[model samples]
Target: MYHVHLPKLEQMGLIEPSGNWYDIRRGPRFDEIEPLLRVIDDHRKKLPGDVL
Candidate 1:
């Protein structure tokens, strides 16, 4: 799955990868969506279990 998604994310400037490491540090796209992601995480944490 890394092979499939990492390149697409990199192409979209959402992430950067070097060797075996993925850089998910704050960036333009990440900054835009981080709040939404945090909201989703908070919601998931509120769930009972097995939300995925």
Candidate 2:
């Protein structure tokens, strides 16, 4: 995840990484996906059991 997922998410502006490996924060574009996240959270029980 450090080499692949994190970098990809950073590139997408979805997350901001601090200097420390375990420290991270929301990126500028987090708002762009917040609605989708809210929708998913609202319907999480209806999703496939393993989806989350």
TM-score for each predicted model, relative to the true structure: 0.58, 0.85
User: Which residue pairs clash in candidate 2?
Assistant: none
Highest lDDT scorer: 2
Error of 1 at 20 (Å): 2.9
Q: Per-residue lDDT for 35 in model 1?
A: 84
In model 1, the runs with Cα more than 4 Å from the true position are: 21-28, 45-52
lDDT (C-alpha) at residue 15 in model 2? 95
What shift in Å separates residue 4 of candidate 1 from its native position after superposition?
A: 0.7
Worst 10 residues of 2 by lDDT: 1-10
lDDT of 1 at 41: 87
Instruction: For candidate 1, write residues 13-45 as lDDT tens digits.
Output: 776665554545443476766788788887997
Could you give candidate 2's per-residue lDDT for residues 1-52 as a string of tens digits?
Answer: 4477888889999999998648999999999999999999999999988898
